[model samples]
Target: MKKGIDWRYRISNKEAMMGVVLAILNFIWWYAFAYGLGSRPVKDYTYILGFPAWFFYSCILGFIVFTILVWIMVKYFFTEVPFDVDEYKKEETE
Candidate 1:
């Protein structure tokens, strides 16, 4: 039932920008923790929650950060489709 005019709302600039920005942010976060913290001496490193500093920051903390960032972007950047979406659906018999 998709209509011709529905394409206008398919993908907004804000949503696309959020995707790209989040992707870059995720890469930098993981890279920094993996390489930045990982480059330091192992003997001098500290443990967090029974895990090494690098692993804890890169894996555990990174996962949490990613989740939060995604949630934030989805909540703020994405546009909510209007409830009257049926207006965009065209009747094929017409």
Candidate 2:
């Protein structure tokens, strides 16, 4: 703790938990699409925008979902704390 410093930032437990949940969701989605579906033998399957089924679901769609999640969290869950350095103020006054 330094005098006259007016900066403080910390991640709360709720924020951390939110991040963990999102990460797990991403992992599961990737696993299901890339490993589970992609591993299947090539059959009369279809592709999205020329991308393989696995890549489309695991990467493209997952990217969209992840972006939305991040946007929502940042918009509503984020907190900005205000900091005031009283010691610095008194020093300047004197």
Candidate 3:
């Protein structure tokens, strides 16, 4: 440990778990609209301009929603914790 110097900012395992969960959620969400829902109701959905509901628009919207969720989690829960360098040093010395 050094005075006026902080050794921190280690990535949390919980963050990794969260990322995995989000990825899975994205996969499920996208898959539901793309395939799970099948090829019927999606085709019936009215288009705004010309593109169909099952086109790139849905994909983009899903990505935007996913991004917002991840951003919220990062902004709220992500944090830096101080690491004990001396503890590691002592273990290495042993």
| CA RMSD, predictions in order | 5.0, 5.6, 7.6
Clashing pairs in 2: none
Ranking by lDDT: 2, 1, 3
lDDT of 2 by residue, 10-94 (tens): 3555677888998999999999999877887778456889988898999999999999999999899976543456764665579
Model 3 steric clash pairs: none
Task: Please give the lDDT score for candidate 1.
Answer: 0.78
Tell me the whole-model lDDT of each prediction, alpha carbons only.
Answer: 0.78, 0.79, 0.70
Model 3 per-residue lDDT tens digits across residues 10-80: 35667788889999998888887666334667556656456555544458678899999999988997775
What ranges in model 3 sit over 4 Å off?
1-11, 41-45, 81-94
Work out the TM-score per prediction. 0.70, 0.70, 0.62
Measured with C-alpha atoms, the lDDT of residue 83 in candidate 1 is 45
**Better candidate number, 1 or 2, judged by lDDT:** 2
- The most accurate candidate by lDDT is 2
In what order do the candidates fall by TM-score, top score first? 1, 2, 3
Off by over 4 Å in 1: 1-11, 82-86, 89-94
